[model samples]
Target: MASPLRFRRSSERWNDDRIIEELYSHLDSNLGARSVTPHYVGPDGFETRRFEMDNGDMALFTWNDDFAYWLGNTETPPALWRTSKYTFDEVPYQIARWGQRELLADLTVESPWLAKYDYLSWFFLPVLFSKDGRETSRAFFRKYDAGFPDTTRDEALSFYERFLRTGALDDYRYTMASKLGTSQYFDKNRMSSAMSEFTVAKLLTEAGYDVIPEIEVTTGHSLDFRADPRNGSHDQSSLVEVTRPQPPTQRAADTPVAALRETAETKSNGQLNEHGGGAVMFVDCSGFRDDEWSAVVGEQPDVRHRPAVVFRARPSGAIDAYKKGSVPLSLSQAVEWV
Candidate 1:
């Protein structure tokens, strides 16, 4: 295991002018032309005219919101804020005087483990890398927790140089899902999908069922959902299979109902039998229209024991009429669990 990184607490009553001067001196020696004049935005939302430092490198000094409150004054400290390279249109502000945006991006990309706890960049890269390869970046993050000092800086820089040489970062980036086409609308879709899943889980819980989502039943076989152990009886639990419907489509005359039936029967007889008196049923909340539902029902077995429910769930808390006592539930109706 790697050592943890140390974080500094906010100091009381620090000299902002001296800090800025030190930062300027450091940047002038290290990164000259890339530095710009520091801009200040005041409480009145007006720009301060005089005493501004402009040396070609773009720098901004803004007040720290928390520190302003702690001082028993509303005046904020001038700090450096920059646009984040990790998130789309996300600009994160920090109190560092040197290497504002450039340093932020460099540190994030260099240290994959720091990505896990939400410093700035997307942490999913390292996560995917670990899942695919055995290399552990967790140690890198642990070292970051040790404190940013001279020795730590050298160590971190060395690690970054070696990491770059190995081309490990390339693998990390390739495994991540495309961030393109992820507009606000697409974000809304993801949010809706998550909320919909939560709603279904909540409904099952309220209806006296134990629900588990994204569970891996076997080594390679995972289910989108499963509900079990209802009525306080482990043997009397039930299983639910959920599906999210896409745009309307004509259902084929021969659906995969037989496959579903066979699987359900096998699970009930094999796994459920061990629990006591559990049953298996399919619950399709795929928002299919009546005709689509009829087509699926036509292919299912006529046996009454194998009961299936098909219903459409709307975001506005409305559930279509239940078919044969199978109830359709929505988010609002299932809020009790949340």
Candidate 2:
């Protein structure tokens, strides 16, 4: 699959006239490309050119004598686009810096709706502006409150913006942000499920673990996180898999407790069962309202799996949580341990 944003490093010497001609020819033919003034000026010593097509596809070529870089969402060019892809942070500072400015300009240059959620726009820039997801992702934030029910769009944006500003998930920006997806239509379930991972990351960080996401294990699947405890003597990694129960109104389980149990049981039967053992299950009830959460927390229903955390978080930075089985990590920082 073509990457949402492509960043490539080329060592074939673009400073030479012959190479430059070949590059332009390939882009012009494949992408119906025409050069325009780059919206953002790159660092000194870098020559930058921006291209646009009738379809709105864009490609940026920037290079200095020592390094040549390509950042674009256009169709794959001949040999250059086939080169390895680099994440936004993997490229050299100058190129990455320019890419941020250039890409952000490309993303927000015309979309006035995005202006208010500056932090969210920047945090999810890769996916929010991706070729396939640009419309749907933005719509989710703009119209759907990013799937947070009973909340205004601005409130939802503020909740996420505040958390993202903490920079806790900066290391996994691409993987995590892309999880919000680029599908043609907005899916509340899928988008909210993706955001659940971010909530789990926040919980894990507050609980004092060095949180690493998308951890690979013996099972073919990738677990959501591997958090190392920072306690004075112990050094064991804990794998956490997160699942979010649909709000009671959205699911057949009309009661909050039933919804939480049914949702967690499905996960226990599927991915967690496949994971075999030694992983913690986190059932997030953040989508629930005061009464729904009151019911679930009041009952403290068992999620069918031990070593599980059942929690609800408010946008106000409040968390009510209960654990089943012997949960190994300390979570007193943010969770009230309800």
Question: What's the TM-score of each model vs. the native?
Answer: 0.30, 0.88
Best by TM-score: 2
Least well predicted 10-residue stretch by lDDT in candidate 2: 15-24
Instruction: Please give the CA lDDT of all the candidate structures.
Output: 0.34, 0.80
What is the RMSD, in Å, between candidate 2 and the native fold over all Cα? Answer: 2.7
- Candidate 2 global CA lDDT score: 0.80
lDDT of 1 by residue, 98-213 (tens): 21333234335556445423321232222312221112233322433111122343443343333234332233232221211122122322322333343445455545555655
- Candidate 1 CA-lDDT value: 0.34
Clashing pairs for model 2 are none
Q: After superposition, how far is residue 233 of candidate 1 from its true place, in Å?
A: 7.7
TM-score between model 2 and native: 0.88
